[model samples]
Target: MSGVVVDVRGLAPVQRFINRLANPDLRALADSLGAELESQTRRRIAEEKTAPDGSPWAPWSAVHAATRHAGHSLLQGDGDLLDSVTYQVSGTQIRWGSPLVYAGVMREGASQGQFGTTRRGGPIPWGDIPGREFLGLSAENEDDLVGITEDWLQELMP
Candidate 1:
């Protein structure tokens, strides 16, 4: 699925250098950032909306809902998307994503496109699916992430 990226370019040169240092303790900073993003994204996914704007995600497509023997509202309703969410930290990089196949589709939404055929043997044209920025940060969430990272970094200073 979609993920979040936090830019650490604004950190003071000294701190930024520390981030790139080849030390185990310094790596904790990246891990802390990753943990924060992972937690927030999970929260947003559980809420089923973009964190920044609160935009609602499109319900499951009719075909998918029908095949799953689930009500329209039940598609992606079991919290699989939320459960699949995870994060990783490698040096200065922090990444988060979901293993769900439809995760990207739900996050980015689909455009109107023709499938092979409809039930009536006519071409199936999917409608535009609105994107839900669940992995994206709201203005306030952004502030919190930054604040949390800065605080973590501050603790690293002598």
Candidate 2:
């Protein structure tokens, strides 16, 4: 109710596959990969300054949400490697192709007055990636975060 709305129909196959995977090895592999991706993304986010008020930039929940969303989006894409593999991230909101996109959206939303001041003077710029108006997060940078999620797609797909 307080966050952006995303269409999940775009990721149905992924949701279904994850639901069906009973292999612990595969599950663990997926988890490990997801954690690595999350860690890298968080590091990049942390490199950015917090709001002018010195508060934390973006919430951890939001970052987690964005990562999960990115995984789901990748699952939904057309790639042979990801077709049968189950990859999921816990606790997320949006479902998109990449974390960069979610970060961009969060950055834009915060900039557009969506979060609206949790501390003192109102919401502040908390994300490192500039908004689309400022060139946004580039594909190269996004790849750096997740290492060509498209490649994961190929690996996951048949």
Candidate 3:
């Protein structure tokens, strides 16, 4: 008795086409997008004068000026926080964040309270630190990321 044999020879082209969208290929694309986003965010943080909502950050306090000697410098102080900004990509997830402990507090703002003492031995009220959004994903940022991803995915089309 002869057994029937199935032929998959015609599927070679299709297999190759599918391989283009494989995890390794997609991961390469994800890495590229993550790097692009990290660069864009860092650039904005350094140069933007206003938040994504088109509002300025709170004015520097007298203590801040006295401590840094450059109250008008905007985001720059010792430059530690800005320098700590970095990004990482794991699998398909891209994370952009700062290593600084105060990064979140600085971006989200803190409630009014005597959290610390000033150099003049006065209480440091939290009202002096208004919530200023320095790092966030804006609508334009989202559009850019999505558009780039779509363009990258289109490359895998047959």
**What lDDT does each candidate get?**
0.68, 0.41, 0.71
Count of residue pairs whose backbone atoms collide, per candidate: 1, 11, 0
Summarize candidate 2's per-residue lDDT along 80-136 as a digit string, tens digits: 222222325554321222433343453454343455545766544443333222112
Off by over 4 Å in 3: 1-13, 22-24, 66-72, 111-127
Candidate 1, clashing residue pairs?
Answer: 52-138
TM-score of 1: 0.62
Prediction RMSDs, each to the true structure: 13.3, 21.0, 4.1
TM-score, structure 3 vs. true: 0.71
Deviation (Å) of 27 in candidate 1: 1.7
lDDT of 1 by residue, 1-158 (tens): 89998786776776855764535375677777778787888877655555357666666566655667442242247777877888887878888878787777667666665345677765444455556666767777778878977887667664
Stretches off by above 4 angstroms in model 1 are 1-24, 58-75, 112-128
TM-score of each model, in listed order: 0.62, 0.26, 0.71
**Which is the leading candidate under lDDT?**
3
Show pairs that collide, candidate 3: none
Residues 73-142 of candidate 3: C-alpha lDDT, one tens digit per residue: 5666766666777778888887776878778777877755537767876665635566667766778877
